[model samples]
Target: MHVEEVFVKARFFRALVVAVSALASSAGFAGEVQVAVAANFTAPVQAIAADFEKDTGNKVVASFGATGQFYAQIKNGAPFEVFLAADDSTPAKLETEGMTVRGSRFTYATGALALWSAKDGYVDSNGDVLKKNEFTHLAIANPKTAPYGLAATQALDKLGLAQAVAPKIVEGQNISQAQQFIATGNAELGFVALSQIYKNGKITSGSAWIVPASLHEPIKQDAVILNKGKDNPVAKQFIDYLKGPKAAAVIKSYGYQL
Candidate 1:
């Protein structure tokens, strides 16, 4: 009789442990949110996510891509709960299409454009760098897909160098890729996001000049919670965290204007 009682108790304990483990797993699943982010905002978004995770105990899984690509994915039923776009157009279109929750969109940051070169003594801040014919290759994002590339084109045109530099230009699919082309020395110079070179309150290495805003239309980045995320408390919390002071500090540190 005693042996039979011991077996029953053991079985009961095993069942209890299994039930508790399942509950823990469910809770963890509830605490995660997925985000679609723009490549230009990658650095700041990472910093913001770290703070958000600490404060809310929620995990954010972010996918970075060009704003237009992200918009297409969201329309095709991508699982993202929120989007941080490189410009206002994508988010606004999502709103019009009812892909995003109405009134859930807001301007998150203003991006800065730069003429950057990884090689020393290659870029001049006074806008005279293009006057020289020494560079063999120049890089910019595909203007049709990437907002930064369009801004770069505008800046070149305003400086009267577009016609001269067009033949030398190599285009990347996105701003981050454009940065990579220059960073890897595949291209001698490129127009890229200022955030890539600015970190920890300074421009550490490489040479760049922040292009004047007057050279192009403003790059106003926007963020939105998708309609699919409307009822997700974790998604709402993440959005709030982005608008909080901690995220703002990170954004400013990365050479973005909030």
Candidate 2:
């Protein structure tokens, strides 16, 4: 009888130990945060996520796409905890609709537009390349969906080159796809995010004219904690970390203007 009682107690204690261990593992996994990011900001955000993970000891998984698409997904119940948008408008709309934490939004970066070509010596720095009509296909993101595309159109319009360049334009669904068009030679030249061209702290194998901000409306990128992230401690920390100097340095290194 004594032996049986001891065995029963041992079994119960072992089960308790296993339960506690499982809880601990679950807590550790919950510390990771998922982020939805605008495609144009992918490069910089990837660098920032690395720094954020190092600083906070938390994991960050980012999905890149057009802001408009992300907005739709979040509304339909995506599991993303944070959103980094290519423009302020969408974030503002999310806030107004109470889909994000109140007052948790801020502009993280100002994006720059660039005319890029994979072929060396193809792009002219003086912005006259468009005037020459030398390229048969020019790529731009879908203006109706991507903020960068709208900025590109505004720039062309401001320069009085819109009509001249319209026929040559090939539209990609997002900035990253547009970059692929130029990078893969599907298009001779494309308007891409400056972050794509400025790799490793320098322009990579392309001549580009960084379109002046005056030529178009500002491309103010904003970050917000989604309503889904309200209960997530790690998500809140990651959002705050993006405003810190560590993340700022990484963002600037990718040619984003903070």
Candidate 3:
């Protein structure tokens, strides 16, 4: 009612509005982020994306493929705002090539390799099935592009069966396709990500020999905000969400190490 009281109230309301706007800009994001995710991380990442949308009202559009392919696409100026690579090397390369925001790279997960079969009991715990040579076709992702494929090659070489099984190998463009090959019986068995066959802290179906971590290099998966996403609040928030407790739990449930 008094002039001084009215002036003080108006100033307080303006300050509150400014504070709320700043908070929205910082955390209350509103945009769809375009993400390039590695094929092996498809399931868990989808789950994480769903949680992020539910919690933050930010949408994520993910494209799953080989890390190497994603790297090439990013280098060529693809519109992806985020890169979730199957291996740290690809993201490091992109950083070196200036395709991503500097100092934005971080390891998100460590993946394990698995020798898997769609048929129950087809693959043994110790992977003796490979030594038996009972199967005609085997599937693997493209070693040049997929990190899991490279790990599979290493495992075969370690077992001294690379030369023997070379002829029966069926290569997929990405790990997801390789999984399809085995799941549909096009191949009797295949090398795939442990996450692909694991669920709820155990193998959900079929059988798998989780390749020893010592047999191959560690699959340190990394995530980076691409140059296109440097200014995207939702993109940055998505990366943060992946490192948060909820997303990490989902990732672990799929057998990936964070």
Best by lDDT: 3
Candidate 1, residue 131: CA error in Å?
2.1
Candidate 2: tens digits of C-alpha lDDT, residues 40-105: 888788887887777767889999999998999999999999999999999999999989998899
lDDT of 3 by residue, 1-258 (tens): 999999999999999999999988967446789999999999998899899989988899999999989888887889999999999999998888888888889999999999999999999999999999879999999999999999999989988999999999999999999999999999999999999999988998788999999989999999999999999888889988998999989998999888
lDDT of each: 0.89, 0.90, 0.93
Task: Give RMSD to native, each candidate.
Answer: 2.6, 3.8, 6.4
- lDDT for 197 in candidate 1 is 89
| Model 3 poorest ten-residue lDDT run | 23-32
CA lDDT, candidate 1, residue 60: 89
TM-scores of all predicted structures: 0.90, 0.89, 0.88
Which 10 consecutive positions of candidate 1 have the poorest summed lDDT?
125-134
Winner on TM-score between 1 and 3 is: 1
Q: Give the clashing pairs for model 3.
A: none
Q: Write the per-residue lDDT of candidate 1 for residues 1-258, one digit (tens) a residue.
A: 699999999999999999999999877665878999988988888888988888877888999878888888899999999999999998999899889888889999999998889987789887578778578899998888788999999999898899998889999888889999999999988899999889876666788888999999999999999988998898889998889898988998998998
Question: Distance (Å) between predicted and true CA of 6, model 2?
Answer: 18
Q: What's the distance in Å from true for residue 234, model 1?
A: 1.4
Ranking by TM-score: 1, 2, 3
